[model samples]
Target chain A: MPSTAEPDALSAGAKRGRPGYDQDSVLNVAVQVFNKHGYDATSMGLLAENLGISKSAIYHHVPSKGDLLRLALDQALVPLEAISEHERARTGTAEERLEFFLRSTIRVLIERQPYVTLLLRLRGNTEIERTALERRRAVDRKVADLVVEAQREGTLREDIDPRTTTRLLFGTINSMVEWFRPDGPAGAQQVEDNAITMMLDGLHTRNL
Target chain B: MPSTAEPDALSAGAKRGRPGYDQDSVLNVAVQVFNKHGYDATSMGLLAENLGISKSAIYHHVPSKGDLLRLALDQALVPLEAISEHERARTGTAEERLEFFLRSTIRVLIERQPYVTLLLRLRGNTEIERTALERRRAVDRKVADLVVEAQREGTLREDIDPRTTTRLLFGTINSMVEWFRPDGPAGAQQVEDNAITMMLDGLHTRNL
Candidate 1:
């Protein structure tokens, strides 16, 4: 039942005898293993083996596998939720605000690719996964609302259904987890720019 | 050792105790189970239980679980590969050809959603999975080549990298597997039209 607190404080009070391990480090390794082997398939023993630490030592950091999943999911979800509430996203013209949301989302996905990948893949098999899905859906609804607003204001195209547009827009962004490499030839800035341009401007050459 | 031939003939010739099943029926159920439980985690025993038949009956239809996966993946990949080879996808301007590929792909996905879902989720853990992935990648490369051709022809906006554009383009279409229900309120034609408009026309209101 270790709580999320300062790494030093939590580690200093640890009684399980594993030194040099913090919750953050443990969570990072856990997310990697979960991504490598799916969440349900990964057991604490496998996680400990991968961490090169005893199961008890791992428990000293987090209580159960669910806690590790929650922490890992939050790594991706928190920043995403922030974008929806940000002043820029809230106050600008619906079009500008939606663009801000998209840009920020792409950045978060690029920076936290593994976490977001795990987040996107959740099939809601467990209570914890279902809760995570609820949070994810809430974020999606907020973005879709922006699309609706933009469409209402006539700044965005009105022909397409807002919900479908939102899904496709986010789908394009989420699919990056499948193949986008942070260290690859395409940089994050390039991806962000290209996504905004392609999404906001038609891919077809304009007469302008 | 049930070859995929006439379902009736295969079922009639089966020496196994169970008489009702065919390779196609078994494959349909196996794919459903595979989609429910992941490919690696699903055992022959589990598939048999879901099929309400004996393990031997299951084996009579397909030699092994890998065979089931191969068959299921083919259900999706074959038609997709066909689209690339289709005359409409080959003869038109690059933009027109790419549009045909996109529309055809959306149709295939909607028609064979369960198979496509399993195919898209493959992680290449087995030889069969790896081969399916290679084929999928080849199809992806062909689509990307279309994008490149469109760009070279100046029909598509050249500012974005063709590879990135291709990924984002197909990414939008492939993302449909996530939530696009063929049975839902939105018909396949509507989803197809929205996706094409969103990808090609941009979401912004046109000045003209």
Candidate 2:
């Protein structure tokens, strides 16, 4: 519920991120708080109080709290869902496709850093969260299969299990969400190039 | 909190894992639940119910919920702290030390998977958690310094910033918690070896 002492600034009916209590504005705030407090730890009262609106106002935009979670989950996974459609991810040589997928993934993560980080932090407390986690694993399995194919082609090494390799590669990539800063030392492109190099070439200086 | 239905399964003095609500038993159950549900989402009532003990009984051992968190955080970091003092990690060349740190970290992670995973999942919901996060970052920074040392000695590549390199290295290692089953197809030694190889040699068939 809106506090009676709501700031003087907000009394004039400041513009909602849209004309009404739009899903986008609500999501922007929800993601921030949910990211801060684990999803289940957050409460409708908290969201309403933060929005300086009654719980009914948020209800006006979305049916329940779960709806906001679903939208945030979508914000994180939808781009990767498009990854399989990328020409390179679809029909390019296994390594080429893997490269495209890696490069494209980094771009998506940086662009949607907050949502992606929120996605990683989710503990599957609810069906929506669990589904997001499952969808993430599915995307990983798809990438693992490509790693297996590349290994079959003798491009990527098979010494590690395809699943293991995929996990490690992703582990490295996903960790970026924890620390990657757009305004920090490296630009997204720089981080992308370095990551691809580390994954493909590794840390040590190579000698043929 | 013992139910009247406290099955004949638990005899009167069979005891709740030790004597009158031992911290160890309480912790063993607490860590499991904390790992399942992020810390902030978990509560004293839930922990008590799961342990099948009265809340006051648990309170008999640990003073507060934060104490349990501190214990779990210790479980995850203490081993790595020991690793830093290992001969190889301490006195070896930068590259050698980095390698030792990586291998040791993977071993420790596998050995302490659940708590370590919980440690990583924590978003510093409390001051104790934030301190844990800071300590973990401090460890990463020390490792990053080693990486910079290696680069200076021309043993490792320098194109990427050392901090990024450190995060990537950790991201890869920390990911082991996500899917590595100790009893899975690849044993810990096998996974560790493959990870080291990949880090040293890379994924593709090299043609340097």
Candidate 3:
């Protein structure tokens, strides 16, 4: 995934006197606006006004508002799909692999929060959204599979159903998007560690 | 709180030749449409169309779409506020009280899933939304206080920050709105039990 922070090399090279915004920068602003206003309520005019660029300038980057939506959704989904298919996520002991998956998913959520937030709120009103939802479900199923494997391996508790375990675990992690600020009083590392400990060790004080 | 399943007695009594809907039923359909299409995007025409009633019929129930928004939001918020202020929630040991809060919260979220879903998705774009957001924050602070008391009483582990713990615990519980079907294989009782066990006991197998 291209970092929104870096200049878009391809766009920069292709256009002479390109508007001050690159595709990544436009996407960054678009995701922010989509998040602030409901996606269905956002228009290209509103997006351009927020971008401080002409409608034609935005068109220079992407063909339509739908294209921006697709790009923005990919920003969140691609990394998550990568995590599910990562060699380490695939090869480790189920317990080890599950931890890696949880930790990695948290990092992705924090890094791509705006994108992920938009992705989560999607209602599948369009074909692009439905396709994105499918990819998201596929990732969810992979994580659930890991939970099942962990339970079967006896490294994790078997009392709780694995699918329920996956849902609760991801639910806890995803809830962070509501209030977690990368620059908040709690650093990302602290938030991640606290979640891991709470998930693995439970919140009760151990007698031993 | 009046159950949506029950007819709206006041509205039923007030009107002659009342449309086939009551206030609770109108609010119920309004909340569903809002959840599906979003609060801002939904208009009275769309709502009336979905409800198979005239726009006048919807207006008979509520003065304006904004009124419906406030009413729908309150349907979710009022119950949550009551939970925080419930006598049992206030009287028990912090650990026991916290458990009650969690269990009661899960029950409310399930019973009022659509309303709560609408509440959670509020963007605070209007005065009513901002007010609802404030009420939500207040409830969160109360829950966090219970966590602080639990940790101080040596029931909950001290390593995690009480506020973060509260957020994660509620985050885990609040997440049930996403995919937890009341009619699904897992009953509400099972979901409540699994969440309580996961939150209090951790998910790892006990070695002792």
Winner by lDDT: 1
Give the per-residue Cα lDDT of candidate 2 at B93.
84
Which ten-residue region of model 2 chain B has the weakest summed lDDT? B1-10
lDDT of 2 by residue, A27-84 (tens): 7778877877668878988988777778877787789989999998899899988898
Q: Please give, for residues A1-208, the per-residue lDDT of candidate 3 as tens digits.
A: 1233445556662465673667778899899889888688899999988887789888988999999999999999999989867789878788889889999999999999999999988889999999999999998898788888888898788778777888899899999888898777888888898998888778888621
Off by over 4 Å in 3: A1-16, B1-16
- Which rank order by TM-score, best down to worst? 1, 3, 2
- Considering only N, C-alpha and C atoms within 3 Å, which residue pairs clash in candidate 3? none
DockQ of each: 0.65, 0.58, 0.62
What is the overall TM-score of model 1 with all chains considered together? 0.91
Which of the numbered candidates is closest to the native, going by highest DockQ? 1
Q: How many residue pairs clash in each candidate?
A: 0, 0, 0
iRMSD for every model? 1.5, 1.9, 1.7
lDDT of 1 by residue, A1-208 (tens): 1232224535643434555567777887788888888898899999888777789887787899999999999999999999977899879798899999999999999999889999998989999899989999998998899999998999998888888888899989999998898778888898888888788786888512
Cα RMSDs of all predictions? 4.3, 5.2, 3.5
- The model with the greater TM-score, 1 or 3, is 1
What is each predicted model's overall lDDT from 0 to 1?
0.85, 0.79, 0.84
List pairs with backbone clashes in candidate 2.
none
Q: Taking the true A–B contacts (Cα pairs closer than 8 Å), what share appears in each candidate?
A: 0.74, 0.74, 0.68
Docking class of 1: medium
lDDT of 3: 0.84
lDDT of model 2, residue B195 = 80
